[model samples]
Target: MAIVELLNQDMKQAMKARDKETLSVIRMVKASMQNEAIKLQKDALSEEEELTVLARELKQRKDSLHEFEEAGREDLVSKLNTEIEIIQAYMPEQLSDEELETIVVQTIEEVQAQSKKDMGKVMSALMPKVKGKAEGSRVNQLVQKNLS
Candidate 1:
Protein backbone atom coordinates (compact mmCIF):
# COMPACT_ATOMS: atom_id res chain seq x y z
CA MET A 1 0.00 0.00 0.00
CA ALA A 2 1.09 3.58 -0.52
CA ILE A 3 2.22 5.47 2.56
CA VAL A 4 -0.89 7.61 2.67
CA GLU A 5 -3.14 4.56 2.48
CA LEU A 6 -1.12 2.70 5.07
CA LEU A 7 -1.22 5.73 7.32
CA ASN A 8 -4.98 6.02 7.01
CA GLN A 9 -5.43 2.37 7.87
CA ASP A 10 -3.07 2.61 10.80
CA MET A 11 -4.77 5.74 12.04
CA LYS A 12 -8.10 3.91 12.15
CA GLN A 13 -6.54 0.97 13.95
CA ALA A 14 -4.87 3.27 16.45
CA MET A 15 -8.16 5.00 17.08
CA LYS A 16 -9.97 1.71 17.58
CA ALA A 17 -7.27 0.46 19.91
CA ARG A 18 -7.12 3.74 21.83
CA ASP A 19 -3.44 4.04 21.11
CA LYS A 20 -2.93 7.70 21.86
CA GLU A 21 0.80 7.84 21.16
CA THR A 22 0.55 5.97 17.89
CA LEU A 23 -2.43 8.04 16.82
CA SER A 24 -0.68 11.33 17.52
CA VAL A 25 2.49 10.28 15.70
CA ILE A 26 0.53 9.06 12.70
CA ARG A 27 -1.42 12.32 12.61
CA MET A 28 1.80 14.28 12.64
CA VAL A 29 3.15 12.20 9.78
CA LYS A 30 0.00 12.78 7.77
CA ALA A 31 0.15 16.52 8.33
CA SER A 32 3.79 16.67 7.38
CA MET A 33 3.17 14.67 4.21
CA GLN A 34 0.31 16.90 3.23
CA ASN A 35 2.34 20.03 3.89
CA GLU A 36 5.15 18.74 1.70
CA ALA A 37 2.75 17.99 -1.13
CA ILE A 38 1.41 21.54 -0.93
CA LYS A 39 4.91 22.99 -0.95
CA LEU A 40 5.81 20.98 -4.05
CA GLN A 41 2.52 21.86 -5.79
CA LYS A 42 1.45 18.25 -6.02
CA ASP A 43 -1.85 16.65 -5.10
CA ALA A 44 -0.19 13.59 -3.66
CA LEU A 45 3.35 12.44 -2.98
CA SER A 46 4.94 9.21 -4.09
CA GLU A 47 6.10 6.69 -1.49
CA GLU A 48 9.70 7.84 -1.85
CA GLU A 49 8.74 11.46 -1.29
CA GLU A 50 6.70 10.48 1.76
CA LEU A 51 9.66 8.54 3.09
CA THR A 52 11.85 11.62 2.69
CA VAL A 53 9.45 13.62 4.84
CA LEU A 54 9.17 10.82 7.39
CA ALA A 55 12.94 10.50 7.57
CA ARG A 56 13.31 14.22 8.19
CA GLU A 57 10.66 14.11 10.94
CA LEU A 58 12.36 11.17 12.59
CA LYS A 59 15.71 12.98 12.45
CA GLN A 60 14.23 16.06 14.09
CA ARG A 61 12.89 13.94 16.92
CA LYS A 62 16.25 12.24 17.34
CA ASP A 63 17.96 15.60 17.48
CA SER A 64 15.43 16.80 20.04
CA LEU A 65 16.00 13.68 22.13
CA HIS A 66 19.74 14.41 22.13
CA GLU A 67 19.18 17.99 23.17
CA PHE A 68 16.78 16.97 25.90
CA GLU A 69 19.29 14.56 27.35
CA GLU A 70 22.05 17.14 27.23
CA ALA A 71 19.83 19.62 29.06
CA GLY A 72 19.16 16.98 31.75
CA ARG A 73 15.47 17.01 30.95
CA GLU A 74 14.82 13.36 31.62
CA ASP A 75 11.06 13.69 31.41
CA LEU A 76 11.13 15.26 27.96
CA VAL A 77 13.82 12.85 26.87
CA SER A 78 11.55 9.90 27.65
CA LYS A 79 8.64 11.50 25.80
CA LEU A 80 10.72 12.30 22.74
CA ASN A 81 12.17 8.84 22.68
CA THR A 82 8.67 7.37 22.66
CA GLU A 83 7.76 9.71 19.81
CA ILE A 84 10.83 8.63 17.90
CA GLU A 85 9.90 5.00 18.31
CA ILE A 86 6.44 5.60 16.93
CA ILE A 87 7.73 7.60 13.97
CA GLN A 88 10.46 5.09 13.18
CA ALA A 89 7.90 2.33 12.61
CA TYR A 90 7.17 3.73 9.17
CA MET A 91 10.79 4.20 8.13
CA PRO A 92 12.83 1.69 6.16
CA GLU A 93 15.30 -0.51 7.97
CA GLN A 94 18.46 1.43 8.78
CA LEU A 95 21.75 0.52 7.16
CA SER A 96 24.33 -1.37 9.16
CA ASP A 97 27.80 0.15 9.64
CA GLU A 98 29.30 -2.36 7.25
CA GLU A 99 26.74 -1.60 4.57
CA LEU A 100 27.19 2.12 5.06
CA GLU A 101 30.94 1.77 4.75
CA THR A 102 30.59 -0.10 1.46
CA ILE A 103 28.30 2.55 0.01
CA VAL A 104 30.61 5.35 1.12
CA VAL A 105 33.58 3.62 -0.49
CA GLN A 106 31.67 3.16 -3.73
CA THR A 107 30.41 6.76 -3.69
CA ILE A 108 33.89 8.17 -3.07
CA GLU A 109 35.23 6.21 -6.02
CA GLU A 110 32.32 7.11 -8.28
CA VAL A 111 32.66 10.78 -7.47
CA GLN A 112 36.47 10.60 -7.81
CA ALA A 113 36.70 12.05 -4.36
CA GLN A 114 40.46 11.87 -3.85
CA SER A 115 40.63 14.53 -1.15
CA LYS A 116 38.58 16.33 1.49
CA LYS A 117 37.88 19.04 -1.06
CA ASP A 118 35.65 16.59 -2.92
CA MET A 119 33.70 15.66 0.20
CA GLY A 120 30.65 17.63 -0.90
CA LYS A 121 30.51 15.87 -4.23
CA VAL A 122 30.91 12.51 -2.56
CA MET A 123 28.13 13.30 -0.08
CA SER A 124 25.80 14.56 -2.80
CA ALA A 125 26.36 11.42 -4.79
CA LEU A 126 25.76 9.19 -1.79
CA MET A 127 22.72 10.84 -0.23
CA PRO A 128 20.23 9.62 -2.85
CA LYS A 129 21.51 6.06 -2.61
CA VAL A 130 21.30 6.06 1.19
CA LYS A 131 18.32 8.28 1.81
CA GLY A 132 15.65 6.99 4.25
CA LYS A 133 17.89 4.01 4.98
CA ALA A 134 20.69 5.85 6.80
CA GLU A 135 21.04 8.84 9.03
CA GLY A 136 22.56 11.93 7.47
CA SER A 137 25.01 12.45 10.32
CA ARG A 138 26.14 8.83 10.07
CA VAL A 139 26.59 9.17 6.32
CA ASN A 140 28.56 12.40 6.82
CA GLN A 141 30.83 10.74 9.36
CA LEU A 142 31.39 7.72 7.13
CA VAL A 143 32.21 9.94 4.14
CA GLN A 144 34.61 12.05 6.21
CA LYS A 145 36.34 8.96 7.58
CA ASN A 146 36.73 7.56 4.07
CA LEU A 147 37.92 10.84 2.58
CA SER A 148 40.46 11.34 5.33
Candidate 2:
Protein backbone atom coordinates (compact mmCIF):
# COMPACT_ATOMS: atom_id res chain seq x y z
CA MET A 1 0.00 0.00 0.00
CA ALA A 2 1.06 3.61 -0.51
CA ILE A 3 2.39 5.28 2.59
CA VAL A 4 -0.46 7.75 2.67
CA GLU A 5 -3.07 5.03 2.40
CA LEU A 6 -1.36 2.97 5.06
CA LEU A 7 -1.14 6.02 7.29
CA ASN A 8 -4.85 6.69 6.83
CA GLN A 9 -5.74 3.15 7.87
CA ASP A 10 -3.43 3.30 10.88
CA MET A 11 -4.77 6.71 11.84
CA LYS A 12 -8.28 5.32 11.89
CA GLN A 13 -7.16 2.35 13.97
CA ALA A 14 -5.31 4.62 16.38
CA MET A 15 -8.36 6.80 16.76
CA LYS A 16 -10.49 3.75 17.47
CA ALA A 17 -7.96 2.44 19.97
CA ARG A 18 -7.46 5.85 21.60
CA ASP A 19 -3.79 5.65 20.74
CA LYS A 20 -2.91 9.32 21.01
CA GLU A 21 0.80 8.88 20.43
CA THR A 22 0.43 6.77 17.29
CA LEU A 23 -2.29 9.06 16.01
CA SER A 24 -0.11 12.13 16.50
CA VAL A 25 2.86 10.54 14.74
CA ILE A 26 0.70 9.40 11.83
CA ARG A 27 -0.73 12.88 11.43
CA MET A 28 2.73 14.36 11.43
CA VAL A 29 3.92 11.97 8.75
CA LYS A 30 0.83 12.55 6.64
CA ALA A 31 1.23 16.31 6.89
CA SER A 32 4.91 16.08 6.02
CA MET A 33 4.11 13.98 2.96
CA GLN A 34 1.32 16.31 1.86
CA ASN A 35 3.61 19.31 2.25
CA GLU A 36 6.32 17.60 0.24
CA ALA A 37 3.87 16.81 -2.56
CA ILE A 38 2.70 20.42 -2.61
CA LYS A 39 6.28 21.69 -2.62
CA LEU A 40 7.15 19.42 -5.54
CA GLN A 41 3.95 20.36 -7.45
CA LYS A 42 2.86 16.74 -7.57
CA ASP A 43 -0.52 15.28 -6.69
CA ALA A 44 1.18 12.45 -4.84
CA LEU A 45 4.65 11.15 -4.03
CA SER A 46 6.26 8.11 -5.62
CA GLU A 47 7.17 5.24 -3.30
CA GLU A 48 10.77 6.36 -3.30
CA GLU A 49 9.72 9.92 -2.51
CA GLU A 50 7.53 8.66 0.30
CA LEU A 51 10.43 6.62 1.61
CA THR A 52 12.60 9.74 1.54
CA VAL A 53 10.09 11.64 3.62
CA LEU A 54 9.73 8.75 6.07
CA ALA A 55 13.50 8.49 6.34
CA ARG A 56 13.74 12.22 7.04
CA GLU A 57 11.14 11.93 9.80
CA LEU A 58 12.96 8.99 11.33
CA LYS A 59 16.25 10.86 11.25
CA GLN A 60 14.73 13.90 12.90
CA ARG A 61 13.31 11.78 15.74
CA LYS A 62 16.63 10.01 16.22
CA ASP A 63 18.51 13.30 16.34
CA SER A 64 16.05 14.66 18.86
CA LEU A 65 16.30 11.45 20.88
CA HIS A 66 20.08 11.81 21.02
CA GLU A 67 19.86 15.44 22.12
CA PHE A 68 17.27 14.58 24.76
CA GLU A 69 19.53 11.83 26.07
CA GLU A 70 22.47 14.21 26.29
CA ALA A 71 20.30 16.75 28.12
CA GLY A 72 19.17 14.05 30.56
CA ARG A 73 15.54 14.62 29.64
CA GLU A 74 14.38 11.07 30.26
CA ASP A 75 10.74 12.01 29.93
CA LEU A 76 11.15 13.46 26.44
CA VAL A 77 13.65 10.76 25.52
CA SER A 78 11.05 8.02 25.97
CA LYS A 79 8.52 9.98 23.94
CA LEU A 80 10.99 10.49 21.14
CA ASN A 81 11.84 6.80 21.24
CA THR A 82 8.16 5.95 20.81
CA GLU A 83 7.89 8.44 17.97
CA ILE A 84 10.90 6.82 16.34
CA GLU A 85 9.27 3.42 16.59
CA ILE A 86 6.07 4.72 15.03
CA ILE A 87 7.90 6.33 12.12
CA GLN A 88 10.03 3.26 11.57
CA ALA A 89 6.97 1.08 10.97
CA TYR A 90 6.59 2.71 7.54
CA MET A 91 10.22 2.37 6.53
CA PRO A 92 11.60 -0.42 4.36
CA GLU A 93 13.25 -3.23 6.26
CA GLN A 94 16.73 -2.14 7.24
CA LEU A 95 19.67 -4.02 5.76
CA SER A 96 21.73 -6.18 8.06
CA ASP A 97 25.34 -5.15 8.57
CA GLU A 98 26.73 -8.10 6.68
CA GLU A 99 24.36 -7.55 3.75
CA LEU A 100 25.24 -3.88 3.74
CA GLU A 101 28.95 -4.65 3.86
CA THR A 102 28.64 -6.96 0.86
CA ILE A 103 26.87 -4.29 -1.12
CA VAL A 104 29.45 -1.73 -0.09
CA VAL A 105 32.26 -3.99 -1.24
CA GLN A 106 30.51 -4.53 -4.57
CA THR A 107 29.96 -0.81 -5.02
CA ILE A 108 33.58 -0.03 -4.22
CA GLU A 109 34.74 -2.57 -6.75
CA GLU A 110 32.27 -1.33 -9.36
CA VAL A 111 33.41 2.25 -8.92
CA GLN A 112 37.04 1.12 -8.89
CA ALA A 113 37.43 3.14 -5.73
CA GLN A 114 41.14 3.16 -4.91
CA SER A 115 41.17 5.01 -1.60
CA LYS A 116 39.23 7.31 0.65
CA LYS A 117 39.64 9.98 -2.04
CA ASP A 118 37.03 8.11 -4.10
CA MET A 119 34.55 8.29 -1.24
CA GLY A 120 32.32 10.70 -3.11
CA LYS A 121 32.23 8.57 -6.22
CA VAL A 122 31.43 5.42 -4.30
CA MET A 123 28.69 7.02 -2.24
CA SER A 124 27.08 8.70 -5.21
CA ALA A 125 26.91 5.39 -7.00
CA LEU A 126 25.97 3.37 -3.95
CA MET A 127 23.20 5.32 -2.22
CA PRO A 128 20.53 4.80 -4.87
CA LYS A 129 21.08 1.06 -4.71
CA VAL A 130 20.55 0.95 -0.96
CA LYS A 131 18.29 3.96 -0.65
CA GLY A 132 15.71 3.54 2.15
CA LYS A 133 17.12 0.21 3.27
CA ALA A 134 20.43 1.54 4.66
CA GLU A 135 21.44 4.59 6.63
CA GLY A 136 23.98 6.86 4.98
CA SER A 137 26.24 7.06 8.03
CA ARG A 138 26.47 3.29 8.28
CA VAL A 139 27.16 3.08 4.56
CA ASN A 140 29.83 5.75 4.87
CA GLN A 141 31.58 3.90 7.68
CA LEU A 142 31.52 0.69 5.66
CA VAL A 143 32.86 2.45 2.57
CA GLN A 144 35.66 3.99 4.58
CA LYS A 145 36.51 0.64 6.10
CA ASN A 146 36.61 -1.02 2.68
CA LEU A 147 38.61 1.76 1.07
CA SER A 148 41.30 1.88 3.73
Give per-residue lDDT, candidate 2, residue 2: 90
Q: Which stretches of candidate 1 lie over 4 Å from their true place?
A: none
Best by lDDT: 2
Instruction: Give a tens-digit lDDT track for model 1, residues 55-88.
Output: 9898889888899999999999988888898888
Instruction: Count clashes in each candidate, considering only residues at least 3 apart in sequence or on different chains.
Output: 0, 0
TM-score attained by model 1? 0.94
Q: Write the per-residue lDDT of candidate 2 for residues 29-75, one digit (tens) a residue.
A: 99999999999999999999999999999999899899999999999
Span of ten consecutive residues with least summed lDDT in model 1? 83-92
Candidates' RMSD to native: 1.1, 0.8
Error of 1 at 64 (Å): 1.5
